[model samples]
Structure formats: structure tokens, C-alpha cells
Target: MGRAPQKVRNRDTNPCIDEGDASLKCLDEHNYDKSCCSAHFQRYKNCRKYWHSVMLQRRGDGVRPDMPTAAERQELLDAIGGKPY
Candidate 1:
């Protein structure tokens, strides 16, 4: 039997994809050497940190499934790098 289809990584509208898409593509093409994509990890880390705080605030405010606005995502991407190719 064949394996299930793999989900696309770094897809559009994904939080860190704006800044990390190029790094992710390079890493995939180069066999995933961690050092080859440190920037991608860093951008994702920053995005995760911001989202953590956002989710915490949402929970305190009785909100469920906290999601970032497009502007919020763009800000994070700007802080890390430019828009995806």
C-alpha cells in the first residue's frame, strides 16, 4: 500500500510562510539540513511567541480559537522578512 499524501509545507496564508517560504523551499531541495534554514525557524519562533501572547489574551477574554488578522500576520512577516515569492 502507498502512504498518505503529504501536506504542503509553508503554504500561503500560513503564519510564517511569508517570511519562511524561500528558506523552506531551499531546505527541502537541500535535504533538510537544519543550518540551511535557520531563518525559517527563527521567523516561526517569533510568530509562535506572538501568537502565544495573543492566544493567552483571547482566553482571558472568553474567546475561542484565536487567530491573527491579516495585518497582524503582515507585521510579523515584516519583522522577519518580506512577502513570499
Candidate 2:
């Protein structure tokens, strides 16, 4: 018989903000100049965008929350076999 799947709970509490608001706050707190602020903001924005996109894709595609992709499976297989791919 198979074991029952585990239940996951939502744990995040921080409110979401747009890229502009986040960057402005980060710049104010860090006292960054225009160029430095822009660069830092861009980095944060890109990271957030990528994370959001991945989350959306996962939900839209109906992928199992814990399932690994082909590349990940291959890596695990290689690791178990003690061989480099």
C-alpha cells in the first residue's frame, strides 16, 4: 500500500509590491546613488520576475508540486551511480 501524501501549508506573510516600489524602498534604505540604485533595482526586479514566472508556469501546467523534471532526474541518476554526466 502507498503512503498518504503530505499536506503543505502556505507560510509566506509578506505583502507583494511592484518592482518600482520595492526598488525605491531598497534605494532609500541603502542610500544608493542613481547608477548603483538602478543596477541593484534591476537585479532585484529580474530575480523577482523569474521567480514569479516559474510559480505561474508551475500552477498553469498542473505539474506535481514535488515531481522532478527530466534534467533533475538525470542528475539524480548520475549521482546515485557515482558517475559524472
Instruction: Give TM-scores for every candidate, taking all chains together and pairing residue i with residue i.
Output: 0.50, 0.38
Give lDDT tens digits, candidate 1, residues 1-85: 8997644453332455545666678689879898878877777677667666766787788865465556765686698796432
Tens digits of lDDT, candidate 2, 1-85? 8997643222231112344566777778778656657765776566456545655676789965533443554465477783221
lDDT of 1: 0.65
TM-score of 2: 0.38
Cα RMSD to native, each candidate?
A: 6.8, 11.8
Say which candidate scores most in lDDT.
1
Alpha carbon deviation, residue 75, candidate 2 (Å): 9.7
| Candidate 2 global CA lDDT score | 0.52
| lDDT for position 61 in model 2 | 92
